[model samples]
Each structure stands twice: as C-alpha cells, then as structure tokens.
Target: MEILPRPFDAQPLDGTSTVPKHVQLRESLRSYIVRSGEPGAAIPSERLLGEYFGVARMTVRQAVDCLVAEEVLERVVGLGTFVARAKVDLHMKMTSYTEEMIRRGMVPDARVLSFEQQGASPLVARELQIEIGQPVVRFRRQLLADGEPMSVDENFIPAHRVVGILDDPPPTSLYSVLSEKYGLVMEWGEDTIEATAASPSIARLLNVEMNAPLLKIQRHAYVARAMIDYSVSYYRADRYKLWVPLQRPGVRSPRAYSSKRLG
Candidate 1:
C-alpha cells in the first residue's frame, strides 16, 4: 500500500525504503507546494491526488497532517484543509502583497474593487511628494485566497506616473506592474497597526459586523528616501495573527512565545 510522505520542507533526497513509502511521497509533494509558492492554494482533491500518487486516501490524510503541524497548511472547520498563511517572523519592509503571501505559504490572488485617478487629499498629498489637490490615481483591491476574502488594500499613486490605469489589471500582485512598467521599486515602509470597530463603510467593504474589531494597518511606503505611496489595510483578524520573533545576538536557541493574558 502507498502512503503520503513527510512534509518538513527537508525530505531526504535519497530513497527512504526504511520509512513508509507514503511518507516519502508526501514529503516530495509537500516540497513541491512550498517551492511552488502555493502554500494555501487549494490542492488537488484527495481522490485525484491519491490516484496520481498511487496512494490510498488515508495515506494522503496522514501526509497532510504533517504539513498542517509544520504550519504549512490549515483546514477551516467547513472549508477543506489548505496551505496556511501564517508568518513566523514579521519583517518591517516594503513588500508586495504577493511576496508576503508566498512567505506565509498562502496562494495569493487580488481583485480590483475600484481604480481611477483623482485629486490628492491633503493627507495623501502630505504623505507623497506632491501638492494638495494634485492629481493622484487611487485604487481599491479586495485581496483573496482560493476564493475567500482576506484583506482590503487601498493605494494612491501620483497621477503623472500612471499614464494608463486598468480597472482590472487581473494580476495577483500590483507591485509587479509598478516595478515592471513604471520602474518603481518598493524600497522601504513604516506600518502602524491598531484594532478598531468596523464602521459602516468598512463593514460594507469587509463584510463584517458593525462594532466588530478589525485589524487595521496603515503604511507609508517609500522608494529610497522619497515617500511614494500610502496604504490603509483592513485584515480579518481571525484569519491573521502577526508575529515578531526577536533574537539577541549570541543568544541561545529560539523559544516559542505565548501571548500573556492580562486580568
């Protein structure tokens, strides 16, 4: 009988006859998903995957458990198990949504809710290198997973740089276009996070209940030293937990951190 292989992202390269063949096979497939950057992407169905790998469904489930324990995949109560998108080390840098998703082992996709050029608001103008009331291109995107709402990102671009804009770029990542088409590279960023009650507008966009606490992260992104973009993000708090692991130089091995509850 065949079984799924292990999933530590470091499966043995040589044959593992001593171990279960299913474990070896699962390790190989798990490696593929990690390297392929589809961490949370929906995997092929168990029946299909079993047939393709010449394994039994039970064996496939065992392999999936290993990935889940590694935090490489997750299973929603109703939704099937998928690659998880949990980041262990939080890096403060200007990174594209797609890159961030891949790091967490989640399959990333984006939908443009709205995109157009508009006059810059006083707040936006001050953040970017532009004058108040200057032309700016604004866009709103509903970032998704296999098909679940995860976050809503809003961006404002200087109008001059946006010679043409697409209401539906239909791309997984926006920075790709900004970098490839406009020669703009995301250099650095500062983010401030807070918990807030969902306003009516936010509730509508995020499909959350009023007064529900939402994770809001405001960012000011720069290209080198110049501030070129600002974004307001509302994330489903239940879906994401931000972690920042600290390491003192010359310190001992890393230890797990547990959030403390205050009375």
Candidate 2:
C-alpha cells in the first residue's frame, strides 16, 4: 500500500493563485489520503501540518474541517483524526445483512435487542398480509460490522410459520434460518427507502446524536407469493448508501445499455 506524502513535500501554495489557501490545502490532504490507501489511518497533527505548510493553525483546521465534513476523515475525541471507512453500498437486491457485510469483507454481528410473540399492529398486518391482532414473532436487533453499530432492524414474521424459532439462538442471518428450519425461501422482495431523523432512542441505539440523518428502509419479503417477512431498518446515513440500477424500457440485456445509473 502507498504511504501518504509528507505535507512539506506537497507543492507550495502560490500567493497569486485564484484558488483559496484552505481549499488548496484541503485538496492536497485529500490526495495524500488517496495515495496512502489506508482507511482509518491517523492524519498529521494540525499544528505540525500548519508549520509544514507555512500556514496559520486556523487555516490548517479549516482544511481538516472540510475533509471531516465530507467524510473523507473522521475525528475521535482523544484519538485524533483518521481516514473514514468506506460507506457500505447496498445495491437493489434481495440479500441478508450478513451476506452484504461478507461481500464487503467485513465481519457481521448482531445483538438481539428484543424478541417476543406479539399481536401485529395494523400496519404490520397490512404489510405481512395477515389479520390485525394476529400473533406474530417480532425480533428487534442491532446489526454491527467490525464491532461498530450499523443498523437497527425490526422484523415481524407470522408466528405460525416459524413455530419454535424463538427457542433457538438469535441468528446472524434470519433468512438463512427461515430457509433451513422452516423451508421458507425468500425469493423476491421490494424495498422502499426514505430519509429520516433519528429518534432519541434510536440515536442512542445507533450511537449517533439525536436528529442525525438516517435511512429508513421498509422491506417486504415473500416466498411463492406468500408474504413472510416485514422488516423496517434504520441505518446511519454516514455509514451506508443505497444503490439502484435503472434500465430504459425494452432494453434486451444489461450489457445493451451504454450507461447505467445508480439512484
């Protein structure tokens, strides 16, 4: 992997240049990070960077602040600034959280927050195509990656279909268990994603500040036209991104399109 070039080695800022000093410094730092090829690597101290660049400490701070705001870097209270992890890109597909993280080379973990059989709410009933007040198994869990919180997922399944699932340990992949134990293979699903603010409880659970931006995903999974899973997940916007591929009508194949866009 390449290492970051020393700040002093960067090209000197020209006094007569049209670009602002802070912007120049920010670009330089960004280049250094890209060349370094190190995610979560600590950056040089602001004071040292200022001295190396012959700029005021405030100017150096401004440069670093820009990178932090753009999520190219992150600041830890006492640990200093470091390169931010690449956000997980979730493409439009039916997949389990475990499968998604594994594809990204990250270890996935889950902490069950709550699990119980409860009467389905009106909305849940509608989504699952079940009667309101019908018994349903509700499982709420915190999905983690590399020991860091990623999303809060709440899933509801018809209790009758998953007879004694509660008796077993919480699974890393709910879909896997559903298939292996209950012979319910989720073949297709639709997801609706929306931007939302973190509620106080959710903020605490996700380790984000209250009102932080979040991506709320509502999913309905089915097996042979039978609605089996209704899940609502809230993901930290800073750490996750959704990718959807679009094709024009009458396109014979994906390869026939010259340009595919992500939404």
Estimate, for each residue in 1-263, the C-alpha lDDT of model 2 and write its tens digit. 43444543555667788999999999988887887638878887887788778899999999999999998999977778989988988686777889888998999999999889999999999999889999999999999999999999999999999999989888779988998999999899989999999999999999988998999999999998889999999999979878777777876665555455432
Candidate 2, residue 78: the lDDT equals 78
Q: Which segments of model 1 are wrong by more than 4 Å?
A: 1-93, 166-171, 247-263
- TM-scores vs. true structure, each candidate: 0.58, 0.78
Candidate 2 wrong stretches, greater than 4 Å:
1-24, 35-51, 55-71, 74-82, 253-263
Which number leads on lDDT? 2
Clashing pairs in 2: none
Q: Rate the local accuracy (lDDT) of all candidates.
A: 0.72, 0.88
Residue 97 in candidate 2, Cα distance off native in Å = 0.6
Q: Name the TM-score of candidate 2.
A: 0.78
Worst 10-residue lDDT window for candidate 1 reads 254-263
